[model samples]
Target: MSLFRLDASILPGTSSSAELADLVEAEWTAAHPGAPVTRRHLGTNPLPSDAWPLAHTGNLTPEPERTPAQREAMALAGTLVAELEAAEAVLLAVPLYNFGVSQHFKAWVDLIIAGAPVGSPVLKDKPTILTTVRGGGYAPGTPREGWDHSTPYLRRILADVWQGDLVIVERELTLAGVSPAMAHLKDLADDLHAKALDAAREAGRQLAAK
Candidate 1:
């Protein structure tokens, strides 16, 4: 089985989501031995911000009339889509940025939609894992209960739009230990971290079974 792992953390070295994803990938490799794992680290090497717009316009224009940049953008979109199409499973490590999807992730999603036919389910029932980490708790009744805008968007794209058999592993209060203001929640954060790790391993096992 082949795995396609995409990371969208601007700070890879310190990303909680990446840490969980590492656990997921580790479990996957343990299950599949020598299976190939393709990686795309959008944080370090992001798609051009202008690519999606160019691709969108290119698709609307006649082939002969498309500019070079448009053609390149279209080709890039095709490649991104091709990666997902070729993978047997997917692992996306996406951390919330300012309560919403990271800019890099949003760009990738836009380009993916632009590359594929309209209303296409890119994942189409393939096994997929999304490990999303947040710096604060947003559970019901919390001060930020309705402030988290990232998770729902992620679900809408990966599960609803792409139609993947998705499983999400989320960890909140990730900054409890690091931020003085959240220090009091450190114990809870540690517990959540442990649980998220366990969930990640479980998700990995599920992906391997696929």
Candidate 2:
């Protein structure tokens, strides 16, 4: 089966979100023994910041009368949507940026939505795993509780908008050992990271089996 993987970690080698996604991909590879993987690294090759507006305008304009800029934007959006449409399963690795959604990921989503026909879901009923890593704790009762805005937004898009069967594997407190202010939560951070990896592996296996 084909798998589409999207990575949105700004930091290449040091990103927990990417690492966790690797674990899931590894598991899937082990199960399929050579399945094709389509990778899109938004961190390094982010969609143009203006692509969204152009896509929106293109979607509104009739195809025969579209401007050159609008045509290019629509073409790019079609390519992005094609990647999703061609895959049997999808994995999105998103790292929390400033306690909010990654602008790159959001831009990608906007393009996909604009590229699709009105009222149609590009990823309808597809199996999707959203792997996320947060630098700080945002659990209930924590100082930064409710601070996570990315996860919910992602869920709304993947599960609600695209109608995907979504599963989330999250690891928080990732900055415990790296950031001086979070030093006290190092042990918990490690534990949470371990759990997220384990969950990712399981999710991959299950998706591959399906």
Candidate 3:
């Protein structure tokens, strides 16, 4: 089985989202034993900011009439979609940025849709997992409750738009030990982080079985 994994954390080693994703990958590797994985690190190698618009134009333009730039943009989008099409499962490690979805992740999604053929369900019913991390607490009763805009938007895109069988694993309070203002919640953060990793591993195993 093949897995396509996308990482959207700028800080690779220090990113909680990346850490949780690693746990899932580890479990998947153990279960599949040498399964091929396609990795896309959008945080480090972000798609062009204007890629979505260019791809949209490319889709409207015929292949022979398309400009070189538009062709390149559309080609990139096709490559991204092809990876998803080839995978049995997909994992996205997304970090909450500026109280919203990462721009890189958003652009990637836009390009995928633009590149896909009309009415084609490229990702329909695919087993997909979204592992997300937030620097602050956003649970009910917390001061920052309702501030988590990223997760909901991602859910809409992955589940509603792509029709993926989506599973979400979330970790919050990631800045508890690092940010002085949140130091008091360090223990809680650690517990939450551990739980998220455990859940990710379990999800990975379940996905492998499927």
Instruction: Report the C-alpha lDDT of model 2 over 29-49, residue by residue, as the tens digit.
Output: 888778799999999999999
List the candidate 1 regions with Cα displacement exceeding 4 Å: none
lDDT of 1 at 192: 94
Candidate number of the best TM-score: 1
Model 2 worst lDDT run, 10 consecutive residues: 114-123
For candidate 3, give the lDDT of residue 137.
88
Against the correct fold, how does model 2 do in TM-score? 0.97
Question: Model 1, range 1-210, lDDT digits (tens) per residue?
Answer: 999999999999999999999999998999999998999999999999999999999999999999999999999999999999999999999999999998889999999999999999999999999999999999999999988899999999999999999999999999898899999999999999999999999988878877
TM-score of 3: 0.95
- Check candidate 1 and list the clashing pairs: none
Every model's TM-score: 0.99, 0.97, 0.95
In candidate 3, what are the lDDT values of residues 63-147, reduced to their tens digit? 8999888988999999999999999999999999989988888899889988898756777999998899999989999988999
Candidate number that wins on TM-score, 2 or 3 = 2
Query: What lDDT score belongs to each candidate, Candidate 1 first?
Result: 0.95, 0.90, 0.90
Instruction: Give the Cα error of residue 160 in candidate 1, in Å.
Output: 0.7
The list of candidate 3 runs beyond 4 A from truth reads none
